[model samples]
Target chain A: MDHIEHLEHTESPANMKKQIWNTFYVLLVLTVVDIALYFALLSSHSIYKNILFVFLGLVKAFYIVSVFMHMKFERKFLASIIILPMLFICFLIWLALTEAGYTFDSRLF
Target chain B: MSNTATLSTDNKQTWGGGKSPLSISYGKLMMWVFLLSDAFTFSSLLVAYGFVRFTFTTSLPNAIVKPFSHLSHTFTEEMQKAGLFVTERWPSPELVFNHFPFLHGIHLPLMFVSLMTFILIFSSVTMVLAVEAGHRMAKKEVEKYMLWTIIGGAAFLGCQAWEWTNLITEGASLQNNPFGPTAFAALFFIVTGFHGTHVLSGVILNIVIYINVINGTYEKRGHYEMVEKVGLYWHFVDLVWVFVFTFFYLI
Candidate 1:
């Protein structure tokens, strides 16, 4: 499809502007909450706090990718192209954590 | 014989490979592929950081070093209040990243980095505005928003330079630090430095595109796809910073 046709099919300038502002506000609020949690959980050594941070971070990341990067407007195949690699990334994280745990145990024993 | 062969091929209609199957231009698709690979690179670095941090926080110290040992003691009362104990030797992020601009020796925790984060996010907003303007074929608006985006990027790079200088002044290198483990400093520099390089290149790219926009290059082309492509890259940079800020600073 042509550019003007694509614009008409997806979003007008005003609608796109609204989405942008909405995302901006959402990201700002999330960051504010993160900062608050940082202070609230400062003295605690809980893994839950870390998990919360990661979850909030992922939320922000999703908003940016979908809205700001315009991935949401793209075709499903393109979106999948971007997302499929993330599974491999999760695998890498699991591997790293496992190795780290093994090393930590060996050092301790 | 030729008519029969043509009829067979026309009926088969092999997938029209020339056109974008995803309804996107090849340029945009290539950009997505590049970004996906870049994300993998960043994930590897961050995962490595996680691994090192886990190991450092779990292993017993050979000996409690001087300043960090003293530093750990200062947090003992608060840790006790929270029902936690200092069992390992990872340097506290709060103490490590407490410097603020023009407030030498004053501890501001994460104030400066938070400001930097806001700057980068604001830049991402401007980038989207630019892309939106491009979609509307508003060249002047696109120029304005692109200029703001570039300024925000440059400002972030300046903040990062100051942060790096502060860290170096505090004797942080890849090999060693007085705070806790050397890996802490090493990963901090490597990950953030790599991100800083991205910001630098983004600013430069924006400037180049800004010049072209002003010169009516995209205006002549009948479509502002270039601006949208660059916008994708800019947003990805901001997205990566979100993770970096969380894993490196807040956690």
Candidate 2:
């Protein structure tokens, strides 16, 4: 019973509720911004507009992971174990988009 | 001095047997790792979307149709006639996903998806709140929040079903898309379909957890870590939606 009780991990701050709502508002605002930017930049069709949208998405992602996911309070070692591996996704995006541009060019001209 | 040496021993003991060095429960840690692997799966799908999307030319500018403008019954046909929907270029998501339930012939571009995003995000918030309540051993609070989370999840699924129906009615499928490219419809269905399946499962899991909460399972066990674990999965579903919204509708 002692060992089983030890397996129960509970570590949350008192103001966690406040933090949750704040993060909710932040996500809400960021999503509204996402839509606003989409329409504002509709006619441009520039790569920078896409990057801007992606950047906003990443901001929203950070808040969700850090607050709602309770990652901010987790141990550094645990956080790294879960987050560090995702760096490969960045590399994959870069590689894929780079190749895609070449494919587009080859097919076009 | 010897105090430093004792501290080193204490640190070593943390890594030694009889303790969890990471300070997380075995099940919760497993949940995190599972979410990480799941994140990778979603990332691969979204990245593939980006790759395929980047290969296609951008959609032509639509200066003719403004938001809130009255749409005709032959909207897709008119767009195709106007060269807005073609095989050689990608179609703007705004034009493709403009229909909302019961508001036909209205050019409300990304509004429905934005509502979907809000639904998923609000559900995620409720889920975390349930986890927070579980920490306090507030059984009633946990039950209420879990129910809300389930409702949010269900509402999101309904919204998706409606959107999917509208698209299918507009003649979108795996092999055929009246929109710009067939691949667009295919990828849209696959990515959002995959994410929708996750939401469905999350709702099911939330229902299970809600039942357990009502039955006082966690209260009897003296911990709500199960809620926390499921909370992580629910949040992950929301996280994937953020990207899906970015790649599919916003981009």
Candidate 3:
């Protein structure tokens, strides 16, 4: 009986749909912006082109992670579990660059 | 280390049926746990791909022309075979994939991948609807939504198939292809092909679950956590496609 009540309570337009279409629309817009950025990177200056590519990539990834992956709805622990590890990953990348750059200065020179 | 032994008793309690065990169900929580682990798995894959891509050996053969010329060569020789060759070579990825549909000959590799990206994302949308229908005990809605998801999955797979054939026969391949660095063909096959296998499995699995849903199998369990659980798996597949799109195609 209680289970039925909870199921009934869970059923509603607000809960079931919950701005899914809105999210889809936003994702669509982001995709178009991504394509535009792709073109601008190709024809524009090279200095910020790489930066633009990485920046757009990160935004797209963030949207997928937070929305489709449901990290936004999860608990704080879940958020930490998801975001904190990426920090470690970033640290590793930094270490790799440091090591690679050392070879450039010492050996390539 | 602490995350190990996931099937242990503590997890058994929390993962399966811990939301007031008598009140809530175990199957749904298990799905959540399964998804959490899958999240890590996909992250590892995307990260590993990054590691390889950053360190990609630049000494590979003529990686770009190899695929295009391979197709152009086929087109020329098969003019008798093809009856009428366009005579123009298939543009490079830097050219072909980058262009808009009607605006042919434009260099838009990222745009093409974006379309594939939307296909998977739309499928994800349909899948969420399936889960919602399951929650409402709307059997017909569930079936309808599941059918949509199946169609979406099929469409994604079809796109992937065209991609693979274009790569192997008309474009770059292991032995063929005039461009790309070393290991490009091999890595391409391994990574994208593996993801294709996952989507295929998701399609089959969704079909089975849909069958069970309509046949009143999960109805005995008194909830559609089965659908939700599979929904998590399906979403994970879609999520992986997102990164694969960004890295393999866009980058």
Better of 1 and 3 by TM-score: 1
Ranked by DockQ, top first: 2, 1, 3
Computed on alpha carbons, the lDDT of every model, listed in order, comes to: 0.81, 0.90, 0.60
In Å, residue A102's CA in model 1 sits off its true spot by 1.2
Candidate that would win on TM-score: 2
State the DockQ of every prediction: 0.44, 0.65, 0.21
What does candidate 3 score on TM? 0.70
User: Candidate 2 DockQ category?
Assistant: medium
Better of 1 and 2 by TM-score: 2
What residue runs in model 2 are displaced by over 4 Å at the alpha carbon? A1-10, B1-10
Models sorted by lDDT, best on top: 2, 1, 3
**Residue B61's C-alpha lDDT in candidate 1?**
23
CAPRI quality level assigned to candidate 1 from its DockQ score: acceptable
Q: Provide the lowest-lDDT 10-residue window in model 2 chain B.
A: B1-10
Can you tell me which runs of candidate 1 are displaced by over 4 Å? A1-14, B1-18, B58-88
How much DockQ does model 3 earn? 0.21
